[model samples]
Target: MSLPTSTASPTPTRSTPRPATPSHRSGYRTGLRWLLQTHGFMFLWALGMLVVLVAAATIIVSNVTTPAGSIVQHARQGLTWFPFSIAIVGITTYTNIHIGAGLTRRSLGWAALTAAVVMAVAYAALFTLALQLERAVYGWTGWAHGVDGAGGLFTSSGQVGLVVLDVGLLFLAGQLSGVLVGIVYYRAGGWWGTLALPLTAGPILLATPALSTAALGDLGLAPRVVLVLLVLGAMSLAAHRLILGVQVRKLAT
Candidate 1:
């Protein structure tokens, strides 16, 4: 009969699966890489400039009078503000770009925190080294190499560990505070951010061994350290919460 009309149904074709989105771990790694790549060179340039300025200041001060106190410490404020400003940009500009790249806010927050730690350690090490170098130079020139400020953790630059600890905590606080200020502004606008500055920026003040000691009158190293850690922890938690709930907005052309 009509060659037995085919009754078999046609086979269904399989659809290709879409590629998987990046994992949180991958996003964190990518975000960290992006932050360092974008900011590392500028940081180096700033460091180099600071070194030159410090050298010139040292020479001038030595010629005028016996160089007393850490010249590098006097310049420490610049170091603090530089990274603070960078961390602010990391939140305000990089956050949106990071999300647009298909990364999660959690990854960006972790990356930013990691970057701040990395930078703080670097600053502390470099600053400590600078102090040691200045001490050596002062020794050669028969000048005093005392650190400025009373009731501070370290009186001598020879106390390498304490110097590093002090500087590291201070820089870390400054960077974290910058992140807090940036996010507050991003979330709550200018007026609130400005008003919140005393609270948002308070960590840096508390972390400063000189300032904190001055205000609290030598609460002892352990107590000072504990206070700093508590402040840092609170700032980090607040920033983390803000970052998680932040809305990604379109950029203007």
Candidate 2:
């Protein structure tokens, strides 16, 4: 009886390892699905922006009289409008996200983060388009645009002194958003209620620099005046953010 046992067959094996964890797979799909859906609104928004942007872009090329300087002027001038318009629309998007997130406690962070990420991407696209516009127009005639110039960190101008200005502006805008969000969260401990102040301040702050540097200061503000406006406005708003934050935390405690 001991010698009568039959040999067993080999077990089957899996050809592939299991895919990503179920949670990870679902999160990835959810993010992708969300981006696709939200991007429709962003696309529609871009159409309106295009009308303005294309006009600005073509203005330099349109003038047959000042062909040589038009492109250069356009590039230099467009920077001012670039940041201002973006800040305006961006804050709105941020507010929308904050509101949507507040729809539920569990989904709030994701909603807010999604808004920020989408807007950042939209901004980058616009920034790149603006640069390409300048480059195409400026480089059209030849290497020389009738002005001896150096390339700024991202511009045809020099990077030395202006890089600080560029970085400073971007950082300031970010700080404006963050501080506002923090203060709002601290004060009321809710999403929708916290967004309006920061969103409003960013545009106003953006206006100062945008007008100062925008296409030859067509806004009529002197560069120095614009700088003063920026510093003062930024400080006021930031202080407001802090005070409100303190009030929020005090109530919470």
Candidate 3:
């Protein structure tokens, strides 16, 4: 019995390996989903509703006062500020959480870029549609929808293509500028961030329809498009670089 026990051996147990970290591609997908789900969709719905409310109010005001200009046009400032603020939050707030969730900085950068593009297109389309609706309402009410110098990109709201192009560029610039601002603030502190406004927030100002019309209108659409693309490209590159080396700070409660 002792000899037989000595010949026997216990079976070895196998240890389970820990799961690998998510890939950058997967991280990008996750980041994009988080951005859209947390901010983009809600903002789009709110913006759409706001546009409708503004259009209705404008109609009422036009009918009562016989106003000469488009009230909806003034909503452009809100549209620009909304995306810009959200983009700043996306960089400052979400970046820490994103990295903590095991996502790569490169993924977050791409996600922000893609989200900006999507939001820009969506805002442009909604603004264009609002203009068309306002135009129809004005026609029905016999109100003169005059174009002011601020809306110099188009002679009339009937210019749907130009409206979309101008709005899209403006929104994209705002978003990119916001990212730049957020990164500067996060990396360089409040003072540097405020000081960097001319560099960080200047792109949106430059991309405004009125400014574009005044400065580059004579250069035609092609040159304006190239200029915008160049600005966007540079902003994107700067943001990407900043994100890559950004140190995640502990968020205050």
Candidate 4:
């Protein structure tokens, strides 16, 4: 008898692929570092320029007539605008590069925010110190250091906390508004951005009511602080909304 032929098919083998090892790309950390470096350099450079300009102005004014008061407060107020402008430019120009290099939009947004807060705090501290230095110089020269003329939270006497808070809030608002404008321009292009300017800049404009008590005529401390905080919150929310799910645009060569 012929042996029965085996008809059982060979067992099919399935090759299992191994799971990928977790990647520690350090993308978030890298983005944060970049933000800090960029922000730090811009701030220092702008501050240096401001110091030179203020010193020149003071010298020129003094030659004509002894300026009655220090310009520290004025200088700090003006300096608030720079951080915002710098942040806007940085965000608009660098988003594509950062994303392409493996950074998430969410990470970039948070990093930008953290850098803004740090920048604000640093500026506030430096500005306060500069004012103190001005006061000392005024003392040495027998001149009054009365340029705290804007007469709001920042201009208050012996209130370093309030001054820091005011400056911090202003810078925060400025930074956020800058981001909003940049994002709007990037998403909506030129004409739409121009039309949207008032909305994007609303927070900055609103803060003015609280920032310059002299111009608004003593709106009271609580009310002014509340206004500033509200504007800051609004701007912050707008920034987040603008930043989420942001699409990176292609740059022209």
Candidate 5:
């Protein structure tokens, strides 16, 4: 009886396999979500402000003795600085809080990068649309559309693709410079950050050629565009490296 009982083997049990994890996709989505959370309202606010400024400038310039062309110049400069200021403040102010809340520095850097690209594209599109609307309104109102060299590449060249590239590069440079400044300030304090001004600002200055109608010395469109793209890439890489080992400071500090 003992031998017979031992001869029979127990049936094997199969454990359920763990679900596959899409880590890269999850990480990318998480980073994108974080950026949207942080900068989402900023974008909306900037757009609203831009509309108001454009409207006010248009009305006053058309009615007063002011040159109508100044409106476009004002808009262009405003858009250029909007993202720059936001990024600089946001990165310095929020990076520690974001890390304390469970996000990695790398993740935040990626998020910032994504946010910068999206912001640039949106700004370019919105600026272009605003100018086009202004043109239509001017035509309907029998006022001259005074867009000239100050109108930026898209306004002056009337090329959507070119303007997008130009504006996008400008914003990218601004965004990168802002992040670079933030990192410099964070790691080296205000004194070193001030000392690092030229290094941090070089990228933004490079964007001038792309954003302006003024001739880039000895550089054609192709060369200028290439230079801009190269500067953007270099700035992005510098920002990334700077963020990798950043020490998170306490809120009070």
Candidate 6:
């Protein structure tokens, strides 16, 4: 007998793609490596600056006139250091994502300049903020002192919080500058290896605050005012160094 004609029903199938496995996600190797290199540069460079400062302080305390060009020399050092630092920090991090992220020296020249501009902007912002904070504190405590001489930039602690913050900012800037210089040293010529970054940053960087202290003191400024200026100047120097650093690293293919 002929098989009874039976209609078969078809089952529907869902075709969604499978989710990515955990192994597919990118790891933190790049960030960790950059952090290691950057932070190492900062610590060693800062310690080196401190040692240099102590030596200079010792000489000055013995009645020797601190060198005439001491502070200016340090400030110049910042030009190379600041830009280079900004460049390396950015380039290094970007490189992990794109191995060939370097630009021509010409382009880097512009980038370096940009870094300097950024430093000024940052300083202005921070200084303004610090001043505002100082005003608020003064308003609440009713404590304000000192006169701002010509070019009030080198003036003092009408506000204690500002005084302390100013010092901290300078110290941090110096440390960051050192780190950038070191990184550039290594990038410019990897052969010097570990020592490259440190030595590159060793010059006037360590003596930044001391240089400022002597310079401001020579102007017959008060200790508190001089302290603030010294710290601020050091920070300015660090900023310049970082800008130069950014330029150097950005150019280093």
In terms of lDDT, which candidate is strongest? 1
**lDDT scores of the candidates, listed in order:** 0.75, 0.40, 0.74, 0.69, 0.68, 0.38
The RMSD of every model to the true structure, in order and in angstroms, is: 13.5, 15.8, 13.4, 15.1, 13.0, 19.5
Clash pairs of candidate 3? none
TM-score of 2: 0.39
Rank the models by TM-score, top first: 1, 3, 4, 5, 2, 6
Runs in model 3 with CA error above 4 Å? 1-21, 41-45, 52-56, 209-211, 251-253
Clash count per candidate = 0, 7, 0, 0, 0, 25
**Candidate 4 Cα deviation (angstroms), residue 11:** 55
**Candidate 4 RMSD computed on C-alpha atoms after optimal superposition onto the true structure:** 15.1
Candidate 1 or 6, higher lDDT?
A: 1
Candidate 2 per-residue lDDT, tens place, 1-253, comes to: 0111111221122243443543322332343234334544645565466647656655745564544432333333334334334433433333334334322221223322333334444444444454455546567745334322322223433332343344334433443354344445444455654456555345435534553443333433246445644653554345343432242123213
**Ordering by lDDT:** 1, 3, 4, 5, 2, 6
User: What residue runs in model 4 are displaced by over 4 Å at the alpha carbon?
Assistant: 1-25, 215-219
Report RMSD for candidate 1. 13.5
The residue pairs that clash in candidate 1, if any, are none
Cα lDDT of model 1 by residue, 28-128, tens digit: 66677776665677578767987899899988987898777778877578778888888887788888788898888877777777677777888777788
Model 5 stretches astray by more than 4 angstroms: 1-28, 65-70, 154-157, 250-253
TM-score each candidate: 0.86, 0.39, 0.83, 0.82, 0.81, 0.37
Candidate 6, superposed: residue stretches over 4 Å from native = 1-88, 94-102, 144-153, 157-193, 203-207, 214-253
Candidate 3 lDDT over residue span 1-253, tens digit each: 0212311331121232333665665666677777766566657665777777786888688568877877777767778888788888878878888899988887777777777777778777777777788778778888887666545466677777778877888888888888899988998889999999999998777766433566654767777777787888888788778887888886678
Candidate 3 lDDT at 186 equals 90
- Compute the lDDT of residue 41 as modeled in candidate 1: 72
